[model samples]
Target: MDTSPYLQSRQRLVPAPPRAVFELLADPAMHPVIDGSGTVRAARGGSPDRLRLGAEFGMDMRLGVPYRISNTVVEFEDGRTIAWRHFSGHRWRYELEPVDGGTLVRETWDASRLKHKWALRVLGFTRTTPGNMERTLERLAAQFDGGATPS
Candidate 1:
């Protein structure tokens, strides 16, 4: 059994360059299309088209009921890494590395600084989040399939 508090998906090799993949990830409007968790509905109006370090954006979300949340890009490194955090304090991070074939992507759900870590544990986020991250990576990879590299 995994004992780490943070949830991370296994690295996936996407058939696209790091810049291409990073372009997709930096666009808030494309999030719903590539989201594997099915929670992201749309980008809220007035949200930035592209995210940069410290940029804030909102998303329409639904788990059981519809709601909205704002996230701030907490970490960004051009075409290599990006991470964001919401009010809940946990962070969602994506790290990209250029490999021989394509870009190696790893998604992580970080709860180390969460205010209510036990609450999330009780809510079973630990058990389910890794799978969600995996699906998210799958969807991300599919976006680059068939040599459709986005600029």
Candidate 2:
């Protein structure tokens, strides 16, 4: 986990190969299945089927109010890491490391570049993000343990 002042991260050892996990991450349509925030409702039209660097995808989100967010893939390293940033300028990143039993997946929420950092911090997202990341990893791991990724 990153201990830096600007990022919150969580790591989990998932019993799935990096390639398999990467495939799921690269597909924007599968995001709602692994999202821990519970805000992602669906992938909207015009989103990419498989995301690559610079690809843009739109997600229907609901957090008391229904809305959509368009995110751009900011980083991609085939089977290793992927990150995206939305209009808010914060980044959501995932890193995968091959381990003995499976893969060590680290998910990060970076708000260092957020325009309204004080506002978000006041909202207590800083305290909530790590737990959400842990749940996200668990859900991703469950997808490999005799369970199907929700469609």
Provide the TM-score for each candidate, comma-separated: 0.92, 0.92
TM-score of 1: 0.92
Off by over 4 Å in 2: 3-6, 147-151
Tens-digit per-residue lDDT, 25-134, candidate 2: 99988889899878888999999889999999999999889999989999999999999998889899999999998899988899997767888768778877887788
Model 1 per-residue lDDT tens digits across residues 93-133: 89999999899998888887776789888887887888777
- Per-residue error for 133 in candidate 1, Å, reads 0.5
Query: Model 1 clash pairs?
Result: none
- Worst 10-residue lDDT window for candidate 2 reads 142-151
Pick the lDDT winner: 2
Candidate 2 structure, TM-score to reference: 0.92
